[model samples]
Target chain A: MEHLDYSNQAAWTRVSGDKQSPVALSDSLAVKNDFETTLSFNYDHTASYVRDTGAGIEVGLHGTANIGNRPFSLNQFHIHTPSEHTVNDKSYEAEIHFVHEASDGRLAVVAVLVQSGAASQTYDAVLAHMNQKETFDIPVDDIMPENKAYYHYIGSLTTPPLTENVEWYVLKQPVTLSTEQINHLKTFYSHNNRDLQALNDRPIISSN
Target chain B: MEHLDYSNQAAWTRVSGDKQSPVALSDSLAVKNDFETTLSFNYDHTASYVRDTGAGIEVGLHGTANIGNRPFSLNQFHIHTPSEHTVNDKSYEAEIHFVHEASDGRLAVVAVLVQSGAASQTYDAVLAHMNQKETFDIPVDDIMPENKAYYHYIGSLTTPPLTENVEWYVLKQPVTLSTEQINHLKTFYSHNNRDLQALNDRPIISSN
Candidate 1:
């Protein structure tokens, strides 16, 4: 019930560091409602990516994500390098995150794993906007992909202050890109990844 | 941008059957930019554990969660069984989801993996409410443990019509509960799980 800041040291410590406590699965947090409006991806909202001061490429992935019947608009895409999650003790170059939210206070995200690949239109859009002199939104309509199939699960934060109770939906298959795509990303965020943490004996469910 | 109901047969068929068509991560369809609260957790509010229609017993090990500088709140906990995700061909009993959101459309979640353990106070809170006959919040303030360490990553929906673009934080270590807790969960919802889908070559990262 208490509100917190993005940089609240104490609160952040509690959220990013509390791993010993048990957490209940809040059913109310699930996306059980229908969104009233429809939103589409804006391949043109190109903006510079910046997390913890590191700069990279970012594009908006628009969509309508509803919760409790209230619709939230999803926007923006970014990546973390070195993979924050480990599957059977394996990690990858980086992971992509799509952020979304509803009008009343509902959140939903669609995450995709980025591995070594060829040049991807999405990545290209991000790269075009990568520059120390620029930090603005761009148009991404030309490069946005059209695939929607995905895998869903509920997981925790991969970073420190390991909080629990987040829903996850990973795509079963990845969109294809060229090797150039991976290299382009690496150019901006060569090591933009968190290390692999322990599974903590948790099971990941595939929402097929 | 077009708004769509997830259950709409036409929408489902349109997006479900196609692989190449762009399932845009559209944000306009759903409501966006309404919630504006911090992302944090609270234990007091998570007293009433409802056997989610699908997820089994969800014990609120920690209190409500607070996101980074947002208005939405992380209310409670829940779980998915039989492994919705597979790291490298392995699975666990169940996964716990700690959901959170902010008022201005910011969302953050911390996920923890649970294994079989001896019955403890945390499990008792959940088991006590397992009957589904009662509908009230539980009192789990005393037994809640501290979770300050974890791994963080960004991911998406773990189910069908997988949405993209969200942040993720998974704890490296899994908290423990008694085998009774696991059994108690199973007694109520035996087959409430999703199968593990293909990895799709997605790279997982750890926020360690």
Candidate 2:
């Protein structure tokens, strides 16, 4: 299998362009607040979130999230330095994508933006064990934020063969990670994010 | 996430009842041998082939396989200490499930049985890297067999939520792994296979 270059002009590139990207979400879109997500940190140490780039320090967390009456299994979550999606053309320090799939094979992704601020215990815990080569367990709720407001849209995976029609929910709230933590992650994947992509006239919906 | 017990009698348990196992396959079944598969080691390390059992030492390989005119991406593959499916009441030492999914979220799986015989370099490579905590790349063709003859059927994932209507292709040929390799895998998951399920009158077709 060939490794995809995250910083190239690949068709599956996830970099969001300022124009045609997701706009400030509005409240007109249907909002479902009861999304239930459960996380288990029993991940494979050999799994890489991004191909090549030597960023193989990812843990597969087995989880399931219930959204809009549909049950999605949380397959994997990886961090992208400098983030993928932009808000009104503003990029964050990092982005965490919680990839979920329904039984029928439909995909729903929850994007959480990471910024430098107060130290987060969740981030600290993840960083602490990032170098472990063995599978372990962790509580899902401990790492998730209480805020559930999000910007919903339909987009494709930012990676190769970039499969489209993926249901995306970008949380309006940003998760806090200290400056030291952000820098530590960058050591693994610096500038390892895709360029902004065309929104193709997709509407960005927000939960009221 | 809490590790799922593979030996338990959960509703989604993969253990099949010996009395109602799949019978010998016939040649009348539709056997598509030319299904095209492309491999990419670009997978989310957070994804597990098995639902639980805390076997997080697995790797996620990304690539698409064309089956029945539909393109299914090779998301992840995992090993069961003992084979999950039985043929005419015969069970192998282990089973490898190559899980593939279509763009619309439909799943098609290819199951290859592993037994003790000559040393297999592919299995050795996978076992060699099983303890690594980082994601890396490997050739899909190296791990897959040249022969495509298989048994066709419709079943559910042996894991939780046990989604049904999944297209299954169990290769007729068994891959050989040294006794040392099989025992090494058992060290991680001795009785990790689920109990056999009742066939429910579903016909198993052979690609003869």
For each prediction in turn, the share of the native Cα contacts (below 8 Å between chains A and B) that it retains comes to 0.02, 0.00
| Candidate 2: tens digits of C-alpha lDDT, residues A1-208 | 2222222312332222222222344455334432232222222323322222232234466655765345567787777788777775678898887888754345677878888887666555566566555454454453356776677766656654244446777877788788988888787766656556654555555554
**What TM-score goes with each of the models?**
0.38, 0.41
TM-score of chain A of each: 0.58, 0.71
Worst 10 residues of 1 chain A by lDDT: A13-22
Estimate, for each residue in B48-108, the C-alpha lDDT of model 2 and write its tens digit.
2222225322456666575544446787787776787766557888888888875434567
With candidate 2 superimposed using the best TM-score fit, by how many Å does residue B27's alpha carbon deviate from the native?
A: 18
Local accuracy of candidate 1 as per-residue lDDT tens digits, A71-136: 447666667654544433445566666656443222355566666655566556556555434565
Clash count of each predicted structure: 170, 30
Runs of candidate 1 exceeding 4 Å displacement = A1-208, B1-40, B58-64, B68-72, B86-90, B104-107, B131-147, B159-165, B198-203
The parts of candidate 2 lying over 4 Å away from their true place are A1-57, A139-142, B1-208
Cα lDDT tens digits for candidate 1, B49-146: 45544334454333445443323355556666543433334455666666565332334556666666645575566666664644455544322335
Per-prediction TM-score, chain B alone: 0.60, 0.72
The candidate that achieves the highest DockQ relative to the unseen native structure: 1
